[model samples]
Target: MLEVLNNDWKRLLEEKMYLCVSIALTICSIVAAIVLTNTMQTKGNIAMVVTDQSANTSLSKKFSSSPYFHVSKMKKAPLESDMVQNRYDAIVTMKEDGSYNIKTIKSDDMKKMIVGALNNPDSYVPSNDKDREIGTNIMGYMMMFVLIQGLFYARFFAKDKEEHIIKRVVTSPIAFRKYLFGHATFILGMIFAPTFAVILIAKILGVAIGFSLLTYALLIAVLSILATAFALFLNSFFCVADTANMIGTATITLTTILAGSFYSFTKKESVLDKLVHLLPQKDFINYVNALEKGHLSRNIELQFIYVLVISAIFFLIAVMKTKRDYVYR
Candidate 1:
């Protein structure tokens, strides 16, 4: 196994495609992190159009003092049409009763900061759950990226089999187990370097890419292993490269969709949610959410272990099937 792994490592290093893909993925991750961080920071800057100029003085003063809120005053009462047309993050209108009607038009982050500032228990203010939900949705998008990338890498295994490279390797003195292990190891190592690079870039940019390095590393390692295992299983079962490719793509797409890659699947309570809970990415996202909330626990550690176990089980099944097919054929 060690020999096979060494050979595979050497082969992988020699492959230009592997290096190109790694560099491309790293660049994509960095770009995404930058875009998200900028969007979030810009959203923190609140632009309020006050209906009553009189109300603007106190609110502007109060909001300007807040680190979360950047208060900008509009010249007049902003029309609904204007709100839609303008870049103002939110529009505030004062009523005769001294209450305010706030309309968030651009970014929810701005809305939340304004609402939180206004509704401080020290001050009589109403809470805005809408912005909170929007923040959660933004986070959901990032999680989706992870799932999409996982699926992208998974398809590579199918491609390898279709190219007859995996079959050729199986005929080599290298045990099938070692070949599989090497494949998984290569992917796991490749994923971590890029993951850490993105995290480090985010930190440098002052984005709160907040997660314990150890936990994040473990989560990514397990995810990479799971992706490789599933890809191998697909490769073993499918006869043609085209069929493997289609099935691999479909499987990853469906799994990601079910895992809340594009949106929060948990928002809708259903059997689908329960089913998605069994997926590795779902557990990973849960752990990330816990980390964001500063609630890391033994349960997260157990989940990481669970992912690794699942990967091993899938790999084992793939090996057995591959071996049987080789023997019979």
Candidate 2:
């Protein structure tokens, strides 16, 4: 296994340009998160609805001036879909009396910010623990790119099959399992290392990541394994690198968005809920949100277990596919 892993890394090292691009993209996303967290003055996005055309704009301007809010003055109320998509953190209907009604799907922490801003316009200080975990924010931004990298990295495996290299290895004394494990390990490390390092360094530098270092490490580790498994599963279906890559890229992008990697929105109906439940990223991000609350619930355990089970199942299927299609055939 070690020998195979070594050979795989050596092959990957030959693609210096690909490695550079991957590293740059991964690190840039993390660094951008850190920079924004440090620099952002507004803690929430609020849509202020004024019913009267001649209404005083001062109330809207007051909320907009507060550090806790980026207020959008709207003649009409924002749509429910906009709230769900996180375009607005909260919707406000302000009366002439200085009182307002707020509707939001965000946590109580965000609700407090809105209330405080309404009461004193100057009172709310952003909490050290932001409404959502910074760790989760990093994951939302970084996950799709890292997973796409996994699909591309597995091109090495696809290339071997295309060039008849895998056929020779399958017939050789070197076990097929070891050869496959080597490729999987290489892909996982390529996906995990730089991404995790950025988080670790940020934590060391006193960034409020909203979770323990150990928890962040575990999250990234699981995500990396799942990404590697996902890549292998797709590649197993199509020996041609381009076809597998195209399908895998589209699947990852769509599923990641639906999973709420960037925004967590609740569905009202059973069918939509069930469809989202099928996605592994949904459970993964749910677990991240759970950890932000600083308690271990049975639901969190289930989400964690679901993510691991899905990753393992993907790998198991890939193994079966290789034995049936490549080796025995």
Candidate 3:
């Protein structure tokens, strides 16, 4: 294992593309989070357009002064066009009789905020959805990066197999078990390095991550192990790099979706919701969120255990398959 790690470290130092990509991705993630947080901080702007020339009144004044809206006046004729283009969250048109009509493309929540703000201006507080938005985006992309890294590992394994490198290594003085361990460790290191770097970069950019750096580092380590093991397991079924990549990518994509990387699937009680608890990404992300709040729950340990167990099972199966098929006396 040490031998493989040493060799991998040297190889990594010599190859700079992975490092470049990792840094680029980290910068992009931080930039995206900043833009998204700002958008959330501002909330949605409600546009007011008065059709009647004499309809300027206290209602428009109230909307302009409200904390929830950034009011803009436009001719009422362009309301539908502006809304379709997402130019405004909502539009208010005043009638000459002091009555008004409201049209909005805003979500129900934003609509409620507008109504609430108008009813009692002093009681209205601006909504801050930055935390939730940032959380979802970070969790989703982190899992995506991990899963794609697994696919890359699978390709690497397949390449070694195709080139008869694994056979040669097994026939060498180095023990097969040590080589396998070293190989897995190397892959995990690759995944963890990029993942941790991205988080640190985001933190440096003033993006609020829920967990402390140390906690996130630990979580990333666990995720890396799971990703590497799963990749090895998938590679066990194929001798060709292309075949393994196809299978690994498809498998990872399906499992990722099931794991709720894109959205929460555990909101309602259902078979899928209950069953997805077995997925590592879902559990890991949830655990990270909890830790961000500075509380460690039983679920955190459960997720850690599940990932370790699944990784062990997959790696053992992969090793056994390799011993049976590739390694020879």
Candidate No. with top TM-score: 2
Point out the worst 10-residue segment of candidate 2 by lDDT.
Answer: 263-272
Alpha carbon lDDT at 256, candidate 3: 81
Summarize candidate 1's per-residue lDDT along 217-315 as a digit string, tens digits.
Answer: 665555556766776676678756567756666777677666754434243355666778788767665665665565669988676567677878878
Model 2 segments more than 4 A misplaced:
41-44, 47-54, 57-67, 74-130, 203-212, 268-271
Stronger candidate by lDDT (1 vs 3):
3
User: How do these models rank on TM-score, best leading?
Assistant: 2, 3, 1
lDDT at residue 55 of model 1 (Cα atoms): 49
**Cα RMSDs, all models:** 7.1, 3.8, 5.9
Of candidates 3 and 2, the better by TM-score: 2
Candidate 2 per-residue C-alpha lDDT over 205-257 given as tens digits, one digit per residue, 9 for 90 to 100: 88777667787778888988999999898888887889999999999999998
- Candidate 2 residue pairs in clash (backbone atoms < 3 Å): none
**Which regions of candidate 3 fall more than 4 Å away from where they truly are?**
6-19, 41-137, 204-207
lDDT of each: 0.58, 0.80, 0.70
Off by over 4 Å in 1: 1-18, 37-171, 204-207, 296-305, 327-329
TM-score-best of 1 and 3: 3
